[model samples]
Target: MDHKQSQIQEAEHAKRSYGSLLNVISKQYGSRDTQYADFSGECYKAVLEECYKKAKIDPSEVCYVEADGCASMITDAMELNSISEVMCKNRKTPLPIGCIKSNIGHTEAASSLVSIAKAVIALRSGIIPPNMHYDSPNPNVPALLNGVLQVVTEPTPLTGNIVGVSSIGMSGTYCHAIIKQNPKVKPTKEPASPIDFPWLVPLSGRVELALNTVFEKIEAMPFDEEFIALAHSIFKTEIKQHLFRGYTLLNAGQQRVHEVKPYDGAEKRPIWFLFSGMGSQWTRMGVDLLRLPTFAKAIRLCHDVLLPKGVNLLEILYSDDPNVYASSILHSFVGIAAIQIGLVDVLKELGVEPDGLVGHSVGELGCAYADGCFTAEQMILSAYARGRASVEATLIKGMMAAYVLKDVINFLGLGYNQIKDQLPPEIEVACHNSEFSCTLSGPVEDMKKYIDTLKQKGIFAKLVNVANIAYHSKFIKPAAPALLKYLKQVIPEPKPRSKRWVSSSIPEALWDSELAKYSSAEYHTNNLLSSVLFEEASAHIPAKAIVIEIAPHGLLQSIVKKSLSKCTNIPLINRFEKDTLKHLFQAIGKMYLGGIDVNIGNLYPKVDYPVSRNVPALHNLLTWDNVKGELISSFMKNKKEGSVIHSWDFIKIYDKRIQNFLGYKINNMEVIPPTVHLVS
Candidate 1:
C-alpha cells in the first residue's frame, strides 16, 4: 500500500479512461460490424430499398440494376440483403446486374457517377453494356453464386424501359437512383411520317465561333430524317442562353446554314404581327393546323360565326379537293380571316402578345379584329359584306400582277408617272409591297398588256394568282359604294381600343380613336382603292421589334424581311410545311432565342402516354466544352458501340419493314428522303 501500489493503481485508472473514450468513438460512428456490413451490403440495401419505396415501383419492373463492384466495394454490395437480391428475388424474371467498374476499373468517388452514367446510357441506347472482367462469380457474393441476381457478362438486349443504378461509398454512405425510360420523353426524332416540309433547325452556342463551329459540323454530317428532330431537341432542352445563334433548313436531303448572328442581351422589344392579305390564301391552308386543339377550336368558333353567312369555310379548309371554292372572293377572305384569328389565339396561348398589328389589303380586317375594333362576328360580317358587294359590283373582269421595279421610290413618283402615261388608261399601281416590289392592277387585258410590255423591256414582273382584283386599285372602285353600304348595315360604328393598329393602306401607325374613322363604310370603301404604304409602316416599327407573320403559310416572311432588313422576322407558320406541329414548335424555339417568354405548360398540353427518353446527339453540345477528350476518344473506339440501336435506327426499321404492314397502302405517303432510305 506504499508508493509501488499507488503507481500501479494510477496506471490502471489511465487504461480504463482510454478504453472508455474508444467505446464512445465506436458508438458515435456506428458499430464496426454494422459499418463493415454497410460498406459491403446493407448501406446499398437501405439506399435501394429507400429508392424503390420512394419511386413506388417493384423490382420486377426494372430491367437491370447497375451494381457497385469496385474492389472491396463488391465485398459489402454482395451481402445477402443487398439491393439486387432484395429487389429481384420475388420476380418471375429476375433482374440482371452490371458493373461499369469491371469495364473501366474503379473510379473512386467518381465510380458511382460513372456507373450511373453508364446505366443512363444503357437505358437510352436500349443495349445492356457487358460487365467485363468477371470470368467467374465471387465465391463470397452469395447473390451471384445462388443465381438470385445475374451479372450481364455479354452485351444483352435491354428487356424493358426501367433500370436501377446503385453506388456505395467507402464510408458506408450509399446511394441508389431509379432511371426509367418514358416512351414520350425520348429525344425528338423524325416521326414515322415522311418528310414533306422544310424543317427549321435552331442552332446556338455560348459564343459566335462556337455556334458557327457547331453549325459547320452539323452541315458536314450526312443528312438524315433525324437531322431536324435532333436540332429541335437541342433547342428545346438545351442552350438556355442565346448569345449567338443561327438556324438551318432541312429540305430535300440538303442542309443550308444561315449566317450566324449575335443577340444583344434582352432589351425589351415590341412584337409586330404582320397579317398577310389575299394572295396568302391557299387551298387547304391551315389543314394541318387542325391537329392542334387550340388552333382548331379557334377555327371552329370562327367557322360557326361565318357559316350562317352561307360560306362553307370548312369545305375549303379540310377538303382534299384543293380547288373547291378556294378562289372565290367570299371563300378566300372568310378563310383568310378565320385562319389569321386562329393564329392569334395560338400565339396568345403561347404567351406572345403583339404590340402592333399591320395588314395588307383584306388583311386590315384581321388587324381590326385583333385590335378589338370589332368582334369576331362583326369582322366576318364585314368581310362577308365586302366580298358579296365586290362580287355584285364588278362590271368588268380584272386582274393584278406583281411588278418588281428597278426603282421603287421613283416608281412611286416620276417612274409611275412615266409608266402611267405609257400604259393604257385602266392600269394603275395598286400596292407598293417593298422597296422594289409593287402590285400592278387594271382590266385583265390591260394588266396582261402592261406585264408583256414590262417583260419586253426586261423588267421583273409576273402575273399574281389572285381571284379578287378589288384591292387598292380603281378596278375595285365599283365595289366601294356597295361595301360602304354593306358595312353600314353590319358595323355602324367602330369601337376602337388602345391597341396599336398599323394601316398598311396609309403605311401609317394608328391606334384607339384614330382607328375609329376606318369603321365607317365610306372610309372602308375609300381604303379599298388607296395605295399600300407598306414601306412607310414598316419604317415606323421599333428598331428592336420582331416582326411575326401571323398567317397559315408564312407568305409574308420574305416581304417582312425585305421591309425590316436587319431586324429579326419570324414566320408563325410555314405554308409549305406539312407537319404543323414541327413548324409551330420551331417558331416557338425561334421566339425563345429572341427573348420571348414561352408558356411551356400551354405549349405542350397534358397527355397520358409513355414518352421515349432517348435524346438526340446535339444534346451532348450542352456540356460540349466540359466533356473530356479521352472519354470521347474512348467512346468512339468501341466498334460495337457503333452497332448500338438508336431512335433513328428504329425509324429506319419502321420505314423499311413495319410501314407496309398487312400489305395495306397508306394514303398521302410522306416523301422519304433518299439519304435515309439509302442508308438501309
Candidate 2:
C-alpha cells in the first residue's frame, strides 16, 4: 500500500463499478494479553464461518477471496493460509485471491467498507484485475507452496455470483462480508404509449416565501430526464402536505406555475358538478380534452353509438372544418353532451367524482348520464332529437342576455323583480340564475337594445350566444311537441332518476308532481319551456361542497359563487384558453387546496419497482435506543459463557448535552437538567 509513496497514485490500480452488497458481520474477541497486543487467529476464522452461514453460501460457493493484504508479510501470509487451508479445506484446486489495499492503499479506519466496495465491483464486472505489484509467492506461507491458495497475479474471469471479503479494525475487531449481484433484474418494457399527461406538481411550505422556494426548486429540476419517475417519486415520498400550497403543471416538456394559495378548510367535503347549457362551444373544442384517455374513451363510447345513424361523432368533434366539427344544431347538441360526459368521466377516473349533480337547460342530459338516468346511447339520441326539433321550430327569432343582480343593484339599485317591471312587454326573464343574477330573453332587436341600455347605465351584462334562439322561454315553445316526440322515441316512458341528480328546471316543490321522473320526455319538454330555477335548486348542494362546472366555459361560475358562497367553484374548461391541460390541473390544484384528495397517482403511468426488504416504511421512525453508552459481548453457541450474565454497576455516565442540562429554558422547559448524568 505504501509502495507509491503518494495516496492519489495508489488509487490508479483499483477498479470501480456498480455492486450489490449481500451481508456484513462484525466480531470482537477478547485478546489473550489485553494489557498488551496479543490476539488469537481463531476469532477471525469463527467470524468468517459466521459470515458464510449468514450469506446462505458455502465456503465452496465463493469463487474468489478478497485478502486483507495490509502489505504485512506475516499477517498476509497467515490470513491466506487460514482461508484456503482451514476454512476452504474442501477445495481441490487453489483459490483465486486479491486485496483492495494493494490497489487503493490502506484507507485505515474505512478500509472495511473499501474492501466491500472492491468486491462489489469485481462481482459486477465479472472480472478481477491483477494484484498490483505482485510477482512471486511468499515462501513464509505454506499454502502458496502447497498449491492450496494462489494470489490473483493476473486478470482472471471471476465465476459465480459470490465474492468474500475480510478486513480488520484496531485491537481485535474483525469484519467479514459477502457481496453478490442483485437478484431482481428489471424486466423489458413494452413500447411507449401516450400515457404521460400533464402532472400537477404539488408544492407547499410553512410560509409564502418557502412555497416560492419550493416552486423554484421544482422548476429547476431536469424534467426531461425520467420526468414521470420524478413526478411519481415526489408523490411517493413522505413529505408533509401543507396548507400553503402552489403547483406547476407539467405537460409534453412544458411547464407553467400557478401562484401560491392557502387552504383553511376544516375537512375534505363532497363534490358537486354543475353542468351549464349552451353558449360555450367552438370549433376544435374537444381537441385539448381529448388528451385524457378517460375523456377520449367517453367520447368514443358515445361516438360509436351515433355512427350507425350516419353520424361520425369522433370525426365531427375533432375535425378542423367549421362546418364539420359537429356543428349542426343536432350534432352540436350531441357534441356538448359528449364533452360534459367526457369531463365527468375524466374527473371520476382521477378520483373526483361528484356527490351531487345539476345542469341548466340541455345540460340536464349530462346530469342524467352521471346519475344513471340515461345510457350513452339514450343521451346522444335524445340530444340529436332535441336539437332537430329545436332547429325545426326556429321561425321566431330571439336572443338572450345574462345579468348579474349585484351589478344591476350597483348601477340601478334594483333587483330582478324591479328590473323585470322596466323590461319591454316582449322581453322575458328566462332564468333566475341565483340571488345575484338573472338572464333575459326576447326578440333579437329588443334583447340587443335592452342589453345596450343596461351597459350604458354602467350595468354589467353580456349577450348569451345561442344563435338567436332563446331557451327556457316562449320563443322555443313550438319545438315542445316534436321534442317530446323524439325524446319519447329515445326513452319511450318515464325513467327513474338517481338521487344524486339535482334538477335546475324542476324546483323541490314540484318533485312530487308528474315531473318526478325528470328523465321523461314530457319532463324534458317542460324543461325547455319553463324558466330555470338554478338558484332554488342550489339549495340541494351541501355546505362546503366543491362545485365543478361541467361546461366548455365557466358560464355559471359567478352564479354559483353568489348562490353558494361557502362552496369552492372549479371550472372544467375555458373556451378562450388554448392550454386545456394546464387550466384543468390548476383547477384540480384549487380543489386540492379546498381539501379534496384529487388522486395524485392518476396523473402518470404506473411503474413496477422492487423495494429492498431491509428498508423500513418510515425511515425516520426510531426502532432502537442508540444514544445509551453500553458494552456488548458475545459467546460461542453452547459455551459456558453464554449462560453467564455479567453485570457492571454503573458509577457514572455523561449525556454530552451537559452544558445546557440544568440551564434556564431556551424553548419550552422552565428549567433544564444542569448536567444529565447516571449515578448507580
Alpha-carbon local distance difference test for all models: 0.63, 0.68
Clashes of 2: 7
lDDT string, candidate 1, 222-298, tens digits: 54433344344335433334556566554523425255665544355688888877677777788877767777888
| TM-scores of the models, in the order given | 0.59, 0.64
lDDT of 1: 0.63
Q: Mark the regions of model 2 whose C-alpha exceeds 4 Å error after superposition.
A: 1-197, 203-215, 224-241, 251-259, 319-327, 405-415, 445-461, 492-495, 539-544, 561-566, 611-680
Q: Given candidate 1, what's the lDDT at residue 323? A: 59
Which numbered prediction scores highest in lDDT against the true structure? 2
| RMSD, one per candidate, in order | 18.6, 13.4
Q: What does candidate 2's lDDT look like per residue over 1-680, in tens digits?
A: 11112122222231111334466788776565664333346777778878877777778777888877877676676577668654567876667888877777766656765776566556545677767877788888877877777778777888777777887655667677776643433223422434555657664444556666656655654443233333434432223434455666654354356578765433457889888887667677777877777778888998888888777888877778866523366666878888888887777766676789888888888888788778877888888887888888854778888886343244332335657789888888888776667888888888878888877876767777666687788788889889988889898755787778887788787787767656888877788898887777788898878899987678787667767889888898887776776687778777766666656656555543322211112212113347986673321222332232233444222655344444456457654332232221
> What TM-score quantifies how close candidate 2 is to the native fold?
0.64
| Residue 230 lDDT (model 1) | 34
